[model samples]
Target: MMQKKAVDSVMEKIIAQDLEHKELESNFWTMSNHKWALLAWASAELDQSAALVHLDWHWDGINDFREPESRGELSALASLDELREMIADRDRPVDYASFIAPAILFGLIDEVHFYCLQDDTTPGLSSDLLDETRAKEYRHHNIDDLLRTTAKLSKPILFDLDIDLFNRATPFYLDGPEYHERIRSFLGKCSDLIQRAAVVTIAKSPSNYWIKNEGHYDWDEELAGELFNEIVPIVR
Candidate 1:
């Protein structure tokens, strides 16, 4: 876990449009920020044309730092190190709020389909990268609908989950009991998807929706642990 100051400094690097922080390894990752999942995806030898199934509280479809003239460069960045270098070289940052579009442009994923637990149905922010890439976004509030739709798709599935989805009412509302129930319900109902996913990436999104404790962000770590324990066996 990064100190509050370290987290803040990294957040500052991410442009306001793609608000977040950074890295983790492995096929199943639980990082402080969702943006780092970008690198995790690149680390794997996933299908070049995989379809992303994003289950989160927010539609993280913003492309904060898109270099249109650098399209060839972006597509050429096939390795995790190359992607990290490209991100470091950019003046603006690639963050949770806006990494999806670039993932598509980079040939990492073909399209992104969303299932937002919160009522945040706003479309992804428009940008030059999204315009030319195969990425398209939408909201699927119903689990059955989301499952049925994905079942028909021929593309490989990359399941991306954000912990914030379990506690959707953040800043505005907080219900401890309801939060636990939401987590249980999702895990119970989505076992099939968990088992089916070609790759699973989870975001611990502490700064975005978690509560602050005596000296640290709360729930993110605990929930991440719980998720790993539950998901590892299923995926394995």
Candidate 2:
């Protein structure tokens, strides 16, 4: 149900010319060959959505965004061409949180997972990226990797982070033990509705937050302000 809103507009513009599908679809948004930059935009949008859903995040702003998404609503909202266009353009300025991603998924990853994914023999592995970048991408690229571990996330949490008992907002940055306590505290006391709502919000957010952003409802800003609020009235 992802309408052609973000990518559709740009797609109309680009498709007018005799552009070939495969030409722009050379996985241009990989770790290298970042020619279009739409990958960044797509990543930003996915990151923003992921951060907001799983880790209680929101966007600061974005810079020059070009192109549109080929389709709509992906696992990471990636692989589309127009989205790659919007991100790569120099005119746009997008910024995001740096620290929170690690907290969301530090423990879940390890050397074995890295090596396994790196193995070219593995089926469905993307052979595009160099073994070096794929091995230690966390060192350079800022991809959140929250959903990177698995398609269905056999082990979603890095350390069983939860959002239930968190009846109140907490700091984005935490030291060590305090982080685990907060997540445990929140999930412990959260109601079923709260838990289900939270998951739905997290899943649909990267792709559907714009439904609220588009002025479809009056409380987009209000609801956005208190992400962990767990109050159904505002968003409903």
Candidate 3:
């Protein structure tokens, strides 16, 4: 059985107070890498179990996060640099593609509803750390499915987005205008969910070369900015 650490720290209390005061200034974050979202998720003052709505171009469910020696391991992560060192453990491999598994296993999130532009080749996550008894996983191929599932979630939500969701296998896949429109449209549809989320993490993923196409190194960064602009008004 997974041992869940108590989340009654002073920071958590402060977060609760902030929510009570309608002070949501710091609940949203943008990171250069996807794994750093772990920091945002851990820092939030959410219920023992929260629902995760992840939008990305890839599944990111590889499930190789080093098992925490104690339940407090995630709560102990103080900074993105510390998280970088933790995920850098070569043998255990807690990377961008695997960070979600630890969050679920550690009880920060109890269920995941995943959406990706990529086809649903990965049916589901099957790992030793994750079983039927642990977190539940749901996959969606389009915005309609994601919205339908999210509308039914009763738990506090952690909304995660990877800018690569707008990427394709080849360079200049959708053209500038169409790509911008798609990003805006998707965010517009999810604005209500984004506003209700207890925590929101956005990944820039500029170095995702496999799906980014060889020469288009900074395209995702551009898209990340576009995503940021789109989200600002909704959360404001």
Give the TM-scores of the predictions, in the order they appear: 0.70, 0.21, 0.70
Compared to the true structure, candidate 3 yields what TM-score?
0.70
What lDDT does candidate 2 reach at residue 111?
Answer: 16
Q: Encode model 2's per-residue lDDT on 1-236: one tens digit a residue.
A: 65769689756544432121112222111111112222322333222222122222222111112223311221233344643443343333321212122212222122111111111233221223223223122221112343343233332211111121121232422444564465445444433323332122221121122214322433243434343244222222
The reply for model 3, stretches above 4 Å from the true place, is 1-24, 66-92, 119-123, 168-173, 208-236
Worst 10 residues of 3 by lDDT: 14-23
Put down candidate 1 lDDT per residue, 1-236, tens digits, no spaces: 88999989876754442323332324665555677677767777775577788987678877654555555666566566777765554354566677787777667787777877444445654645556764665567676778777877776678887766655344313355555556566666777776677677877565533533223344455655565455434433
What local distance difference test score does each model get? 0.63, 0.26, 0.66
Q: Write the per-residue lDDT of candidate 3 for residues 128-191, one digit (tens) a residue.
A: 5566337778888677888988998778999888767666443226665676566577688898
- In model 1, pairs of residues that clash are 62-98
Which stretches in model 2 have alpha-carbon errors above 4 Å?
A: 1-79, 93-178, 187-236
Ten contiguous residues minimizing lDDT sum, candidate 2: 110-119
Among these predictions, the greatest TM-score belongs to 3
